[model samples]
Target: MQTTGISYSETSVRGRSRPSSFRQRFKHSASWLKGVAVALTLGSLLSGCGVVNHMIYKTTGDVMQGFSRDHTIPYLMASGDLAMGCAMSEATAPLLMSFGRVTNEPDQLAVMLYLSAGGCAEEQGREHELAALAAMYERKGNAAEDAIIRQKRAYSLAAKRYLKGWQHHNTYYGEPGTGECPDFDDDMDEFIYFAGLLAGLQALNSEIQSTSSIGVPKNVGSVVARASSCLESDKWWGAPMALKATVWAMIPGAQPEGEDAFERLAMTDRMGDEAGVRLSHVFHAIAATNKGDEAMVKSVVRQHAESLKEQPANEDWAFVDAMATNMIIAISDRLWVENTGHRTPLGRLGTFWDDQKAEVETMDLDGLL
Candidate 1:
C-alpha cells in the first residue's frame, strides 16, 4: 500500500500528535528548581536581616549600659537629692532593664537599680507604718487599720524587689559567703558589691516586716555579715563595719568572741563623722532600736545632728551624707509620730517633743530638699 510514511518525531497515532514527554518533564523540573532557588535566597536574606538587627540591638545595649553606669551613676552619687534619686530610679528601671533582653544581661546594674527602687518602696512603707502607729496612739482605729494595710503592701513590694536585687547580686558576684570575694575593678565596683550585700540584708528585713512568704533566704543576714569584711571599711566611711555590727545585733550568737558589736559601732561612728559620711549612725541607730534601747537611738540621732553642724558634708560624697541624714530623719520621725502623733518638725530632726530647751542646730537642706 502507498501509505504516507510519517516521521517518527511528528508521527500521530489515533488522530492525535504526541508531544515530547521527556522535554515537558525537563521543563517542569527546571521551573520547580527555580522556585526553590528563589525561596532559599529569600530565607538567606531574612536570616541575614535577623542577624543585623541583633547586632544593632546588642551594640545599643552596650552603649546605654555603659553610659548609665559610668556617667549616670557617678552624677547621682555626687548629687545630694534623695527623693529625686529615688524617683529617677523607680521611673527608669523598667526602661534600663529592658535592654537585657537584646544583649548580655545587665546583672550588675540590676543590683543597684532594684536596690534603689526597693529603698523607695521601703521608705513609703515606713511612712505608712508611722502613720498607722500614730493613728492607733490617737484612737483612730479605722485609719490605723487602713494605714496598716498600705504599709504591708508597700513592704511586700519592697521585699520582692530587694530579693530580686539580691538574686542579681548573687548572679554577678556569686552568692556571698559561698566563696572568696571577687577582684573588684575599682572603687565603684567595690561600692556596688557592698550595696548588693545591703540589698540582701534589706530583703530579709523587708520580708519579715511585710509578713509575707517572699522566699528571702534565712541565711542572707549571716552571709552579708561575713561578706562585709570583703570591702575596705575605712574607704567606705565605716559602712561595712556598721553593716556587720548591725547583723551581730540582730542575729543571736552572730557576734564572735572578742568582738563586741557596740564597740565596733562606736568605732564606725567616729569613722563616719570624720569622713563626713554618717551612714554608720543609721546602723548604730538600727542596732539600738533592735535592742529596744530608745535612749541610745535618740542619742545616735543627736550625735548625727551635732556632727552635721560641726563639719560640712564631704563635698565629694554629699549624696551619701545626705542619704544617712535622711535615714536618721526617718528614725526621728518614727519616734516623733509614736509619742507626739506627728512627724519631726521640718527642721527639728535632732530635737524631740520632750527635749530641754537648747540652741537650735542649723543644717544644709540638700538632703531634705
Candidate 2:
C-alpha cells in the first residue's frame, strides 16, 4: 500500500527522444492499464488463492535452506544471484561484491572496480597505482612526492564522479546524507538497507584493519553507528531483521536499542517465521564474538531450536536453516577458541574452525587473542 501510493504513473513520452501529444499519452496509459486488468483477470481465474499459496510455500521452502559445508559455494552463489537480481543498477556494487560473480552483469563491473580501488582484492589492477603512491611517500624525491599527491587527487576525483553519477541515474535512495535516505517512496528499503550495510561494513573492515587509506577508524566507526540507526528505522520484517542484527553485532561497541522489533510481528508457528528462528543464531554469534554473557546466547539458540524442531520444513525454510546452521557453526568455533585454545570438545576444529588464519591471509586482519 505504501509503495502503491507513491507510484506516480510517469508519462511514457518523458524518457523518449520524440515527444507525444497529451491525447496520445493518455491513450497509451489506458491501453497499458487495460492489459494489466486483463492479465490479472486471467491469472485469478486460472489459479485462485490456492495457486498463490502454493507458490509462496515453494519459495519459502527454497529460501530456508541455509549454508552448510556441502552447500557453501552454492549458497553463496545463490545469495549473490538474489542480490544482483534485486539490484537496479551499478550504484549497488558494494553489496554485490560481497558474493563473488558468476556472469558478467554490467552493474557488477563498477562494484569490482570500486573494490579494486579500495584494495579489496589481492591482485587489483589499481594496486600498481596504490603502490606508486606508497613509493612516492617512501622516497625523498620531488617527482615521487608529486606522484603520490596526484594519485590521491585522482582517487578523490574518481570517487566524486561516481557519487555524482549514481545520484543522477539511481532511482532508489541517493548518496546517504543527501536527505534522500528518509524518503518513504518505495518498498526498496531492503535494497537500501543492504547497500548501507555493505558500504558500512566495507569501511569498517578496511579502516579498522588498516588495509585501506580511504577509511579511517574514527570514520568507519561512525559509519557503523549510522548504519545501525538506519537498519533500526528501516522496515525489516523477518530474515532481514536477523541479517541486520547479525551485521550490527560485528560493530565494535555497538549497542542499539529496540532489539525486540522482530517479536512484534505476528508470525505463525510455520517455518515462515524463519527470521525469528534465525535471530537466535545471531544472538549466539554476538555473544560468542564479543565474549558477552554466554547464558543469554545459549538461551536464545535453545529456545529457537525447540520451537523450530516442531515446525514443518517448507522449501523457503531452507534459507533459515542455512543461516542458523552457519551461525551455530560460527558460535561453536568461537567457543572452542575461547575455551580451549581453538580446540573443540568434539576434536581439533581443523578446516572448519581455521577461519583465523584464512581471515588474516585474505583480509590482512590482525589475529588478536
Candidate 3:
C-alpha cells in the first residue's frame, strides 16, 4: 500500500488536515507569552524614575479631590464640621503642595493646597496668639514682649498665606485679582468660594488680633452678608447662620429686625448636632468671649464638653475631629489660664470642668488665710 511509507498519525495531519490540538495549545501559549513580554516592557518603560510616583500622587490627589468634593466635603459642611474639613485640607497640604510645585497649572487641587496651607497658617497664628496670652499671664516682662512679637509675626505669616490662597482662588475661578467676591454654581463650588471668603476673614481676624491696621475694605461686612445669602442654610449645616450671628455680634447694628444674635447662635447648636459637627459652638464661644459674657462662654463650653462625651468625632474624619477638639480645648485652655494660671489638665481637655482639682476656685484658700 502507498501508506506503508508514512505513519498513520503523520498521514492524518497532511495537507488540508486540521492541526493537532496540542499544537494549537502551544501556539496559544506562545502568543500569550509574547503578550506578557510586551506588557512587562511597556510597564517598565512607564514606571521609569519618578514617573510612577508622580502619576500615583496625581491620580491619588485627583481621587481624593473628587471624594472630598462629592462625599466628605458635603457631609462635613452639612454637619457644620469645617474644623475637620480644615484638618482634612491641612493633612493633605504637603502632598498637594508638592504636586503644585511639579506642575504650574492652576487646577482645583492647587487651589485646595493653597487654601489648606493658608488655614494651617491661620491656625498657627491662633496658637501664637494663645502663647502670647500665656506669656502675658506669666507676668514676665521681656517674655510677654517676645511672645507679642512672635504673635505678630505669626499673624503676618497667616495674612500672607491667606492672601495667596485668595489670589489662587480668584485666578482659578476667573474672578478679579483684588479679592472681589466670586459666584458659584453648586454646593461644592459654594463651599470652595466660601473658603476664600473665610481666608479673607481669617486674615482680617489675625490683623485685628495683632492690633495691626491692614488695608481691608470697609465694605467687607456687606460683601460677606451678600455672599452669606447664597449659602443654603439647610445644606450648609447652619454655617451661614453662625456666620451671620457672629457678624451681628461683632458689628454694630448688623443684627436684622426680630433676629437675636444669641438666639441665632443657639440655633447653630441644633443644626450642628443634626449634621454631627458642632464647630459653630466654637464660633459662638468665641463671640461670647469677645462680648465679655462669661456666663454665655461657660454655657457654650459646658455644652461643647458634654456633646463631645456623648458623641466623639467620626474616625473617617479623624483629622477634622482632632481639630475640632483642639479648637475647643484651646478655648478651654485660655479660660483656664486666665483663671487658674495654667492650661487644661492632662487628658481633661474637653472635660476640664469635670476635674475639681483643676478649678481655679478650688486652689487652697487656707494658705491665703
Tell me the lDDT of model 1 at 306. Answer: 95
The lDDT of model 2 is 0.40
Q: Which stretches of candidate 2 lie over 4 Å from their true place?
A: 1-173, 177-179, 182-189, 195-199, 202-217, 221-280, 300-308, 311-321, 337-369
Task: Tell me the alpha-carbon RMSD of every candidate.
Answer: 8.1, 23.3, 13.2
Best by TM-score: 1
Instruction: Give the lowest summed-lDDT range of ten residues in model 1.
Output: 6-15
- In every candidate, how many clashes are there? 0, 17, 1
Greater lDDT among 1 and 3 belongs to 1
What is candidate 3's local distance difference test score? 0.66
Query: How do these models rank on lDDT, best leading?
Result: 1, 3, 2
TM per candidate comes to 0.85, 0.36, 0.65
Tens-place lDDT digits, model 2, residues 244-285: 444455555444675532242112112233433343344334
Q: Write the per-residue lDDT of candidate 1 for residues 244-301, one digit (tens) a residue.
A: 9999998999999889998899999999999999999999999999999999999999
TM-score of 2: 0.36
- lDDT of all predictions, in order shown? 0.91, 0.40, 0.66
Candidate 2, residue 252: CA error in Å? Answer: 8.9
| C-alpha positional error of residue 171 in candidate 1 after TM-score superposition, expressed in Å | 0.9
